[model samples]
Target: MSTLQTSINGADSSVAVIIPSKPNPLTVTYKDLVTECSSFQHKLAAIGITNRSPVSIATVNSYEFIVSFLATSWQRGIAAPLNPAYKQDEFEFYIEDIKSAIVLVPKGAYDTDAPSVKAARKFNAAVAECYWDNVKKEVALDVKDLGQLKGHSKENILQAQPDDVALVLHTSGTTSRPKVVCHRSSQMSVIDVNVNELLC
Candidate 1:
């Protein structure tokens, strides 16, 4: 794990992330952030998502994006964030290419009529529904039957090795069809450093 994640001290209650959204900006501390990420990681592993498996996250820019991305990383899984504005066919193409284990839609954004949902079903990829936990002020995955899975999960954080895949991004395909580029953990860790600095 990068120092960013491994250094998270749940005992320290200082604020870590402030998510500005409607109604009110949600303020999350280091403890809450770590807790939610670990929870979601187990939920993901229970659903057959393992290291290197791609999980497509289709949502607008929000706190959900940050939490889900970190949670997926915790599980040693590859996160594939796609544009929510993609049409059904566009979503289909990307999902098929990644062989995504599941497609995560935004909280309160689940609808059978939604393009992401429709495409997930067409490709036999599970549709994971998450909701914003107002009380907890974080994004949560729906994993009711995961009691046993979470219980058996190891507490040790899953650190990224130099060669482990972390993220998969696509080119604009300006010259030809879009090409999928796999980013290794070492590379992403470095990028994360700059990203965190900017966010801070």
Candidate 2:
């Protein structure tokens, strides 16, 4: 299995997450998490994200960030997580570096003027939205516009190989520019599983 199946190992009755910071932890099951990932992965593929395509998540620490990263990896694309506190130059560098096909930010005007959104727009990346659906009581992902390359069949999602890049992180870059760290499927799956187990 790849990083996409992180929570599959711990599908038992465990506290999956909490809603916001209200100290109300949500009782999420493994089957439920996998279903969400499957649904979101189809959405990612529908928006033209193919194998090796980069999808940058510019948001705070929340369920949206977790789902987005997993969905991207599930689509056999690269998941590039970014710090929402980045300034203009930092955002520009990362957006350009990854050549992201899409950028998911919090729903509403939160990211309207964000440097990350601006930089992604320069490259014509589809800026999407992630929001908490009160009715469903779940974090949902939405996109205003799909890329031109969209509309491919979602019937067959490409599987990640051991050498395929699943996650891309950047170093603080003291010597020169930020250095990108690429993690393969094997490494990413392990990292995701370990981190998810601890956090969730």
Candidate 3:
């Protein structure tokens, strides 16, 4: 199997994502999705996000989250999706456990001094707000604090290897400390293929 990055190709004009909104639902074509993801990936690389860098994403289900998650993986970074509803302590635990290089939150998260932001700051992890700018017509990565990436030179855009860790998830620490799980690039690709096959 191939990596998720390499497998994310399709007919250009085909609908790749849709977000239901109040006034209208947003639709994204494969061309737009791929293009935006690559652009974001470049931004990530510019900020020193390299292979295996843990990128904790604390945004909810939205277009920004999709772009950030996909872009992180495309840049060969480990995407760690966190629940936005998580408490400060929970966020701190996860962020520290993963040694997250950066934490992505919704727009204005910095101004609000969000819990995720606080937790990231506490651990010296970088913090950035990820959001879709209607005027800019693209995803914006507003770096509030470079933290860990401070003084780190720009990183080159890297390709995802089949064995590279693409995603990191955790089990709810109901009884004890949460356990971490790593998913390889090849495994993600295979899962995507299987899901598509089932749909077809």
Task: Give the local distance difference test score of model 1.
Answer: 0.71
- lDDT tens digits, residue span 149-176, model 1: 2344344446545666777899998999
TM-score of each: 0.80, 0.83, 0.93
Off by over 4 Å in 3: 191-200
Off by over 4 Å in 1: 1-4, 7-12, 135-137, 143-159, 191-200
Instruction: State how far residue 17 of model 3 sits from its true place (Å).
Output: 0.3
Question: Considering only N, C-alpha and C atoms within 3 Å, which residue pairs clash in candidate 3?
Answer: none
Clashing pairs in 2: none
For candidate 2, report its TM-score: 0.83
Measured on C-alpha atoms, candidate 2 has an lDDT of: 0.69
The deviation in Å at residue 157 for candidate 2 is 2.8
- Top lDDT prediction, candidate number: 3
Ranking by TM-score: 3, 2, 1
lDDT of 2 by residue, 1-200 (tens): 44445425545544444444555654555566666667788777766788888888888777667667777777788988877778767777887898887877777733366676676666777778776666886667677545434564543565556677888989979888888899877776655443354233
Question: For residues 1-200, could you state the per-residue lDDT of candidate 3 as single tens digits?
Answer: 59877776655677777777869777888777788989999999999999889999998878888788778888999999998889999899999999999999998889999999999999999999998888998999999999989999999988889899988999877998889999898888864432223112
